[model samples]
Target: MTTLLCDADGTLFPSEEPAYAASAEVTNRFLAELGAERPFAPEELQAMTNGKNFRAAAQELARGYGRDLAGADLDAWVGQEKDVVTAHLRTVLRPDAAVRDPLRTLAGRFGLAAVTSSASSRLAACLEVTDLADLFDAARRFSAEDSLPVPTSKPDPAVYAFAGRELGVTPDEAVAVEDSINGALSAVAAGFPTIGTVQFVPGDDREARAEALREAGAAVVVSSWAEVVELLT
Candidate 1:
């Protein structure tokens, strides 16, 4: 049976609108506190923030601000933003039932796992909210916390590799479901058959992103996780 490695954010749960908004608010607050002008608009920040872990995004923003903020400051900033974002998220973010049912169906036929850039704690919260917390084998949940060295952030193959390792499978035998270009690329790089979910319709860029992933070797680009199940099954 093929082992399925899925991305968490835009793949398992809907894009966190509240978290994105809170990120903008916190970023603006941080800038104001640093006595700096807003360097990027909310949309721009959101674009950068997507498909990245909080710490990495925070460090990138710090560099953009010329703050050289690292270590504790970066950690604290990420922690604060997560707390603020998750509070708002608890009410709004929900799983796509369309995807969940297929996952339940597929689970009986394949070994299912979640490989995400999110921290375990945050992933746990999302899983609980989505009612998918108990569906996965506990050993199959791979998170950023399991990332080694530079933290196995996506677009890099390490995260997918870790998930495959946990399942005792080769990446080639795994099928990865992702919603972002980076996440799809990571699986492709790891030699997994990758399916990209186009969660947003970003006009010209949407086609461009899909083309890029296809060029980078994604097996297919789909609009929903249900398509992934159909393709595999």
Candidate 2:
């Protein structure tokens, strides 16, 4: 493949937990505003919404709580969550030699792009904090939330398709590196050869998570960036 479409969040860095932890307050407030049964604790919320974005996760839980999200001020909630979570992520994200070294090698060999379901600003923050910003240019960073006209989440291939068109390539010409089932589904559905990794998943859950990614149409699943580099190079 000529281009490497790398997913952020769980794939690039372990930002899922802390990002979700940051979202807890806003999510709980959203739940209460919707008159749901009770507020969700940070860990509980993270466990429940593991790989989803705020809008998707909130709506899914709202259904369980007998609330309709149709007319909710979703923009407001999304904005608030982004504000809190981005700030929290900046404090927690750090450079990891494990991912950075392999990624640096890969960047020299392929066109590296940041493809994520996060807002572009948040993606920038994560990349910056994790010492990965230089590998991807601002033009190469595409976000499903901020880059797409409709702002949809993963498992919807609009963002990937859009990236291909913008980058002058087709799906088959690119390799997708994703860490979650939905993320894998998105890339595969868009016709990219996907490599799924559970590197950021907890030790006990990695195997099961890898299986899920395989089922989602990832060509193969890996546990670390070293394996990723080995396969690509």
Write out the backbone clash pairs for model 1: none
Off by over 4 Å in 1: 33-35, 39-41, 145-152, 200-206
Worst 10 residues of 1 by lDDT: 144-153
What is candidate 1's lDDT per residue for 1-233, written digit by digit as tens? 47888888877887544567767878877777666664556667768767777776776666776778777776788788777766666777666688679889888788889898777767777887888887776678887644455554677778788777767898667788887777877788888888877755355566877787788688789876677777889
Separate clash counts for every candidate: 0, 0
How far residue 179's Cα lies from its native spot in candidate 1, in Å, is 0.9
- Per-candidate TM equals 0.87, 0.94
- Superposed by TM-score, candidate 2 places the C-alpha of residue 37 at a distance from the truth, in angstroms, of 1.7
RMSD of each: 2.4, 1.6
- Report lDDT per candidate: 0.75, 0.87
Please provide, for model 2 over 1-233, each residue's C-alpha lDDT reduced to its tens digit, 9 standing for 90 to 100.
78999999899999988888888888888888778677778888877766567877766877887876754477778888988999999999999999999999998899999888888889999999999999989999998888987777787888889998899888767999999888898899899999999889989989899999999999999999999999999
Best by lDDT: 2
Clashing pairs in 2: none
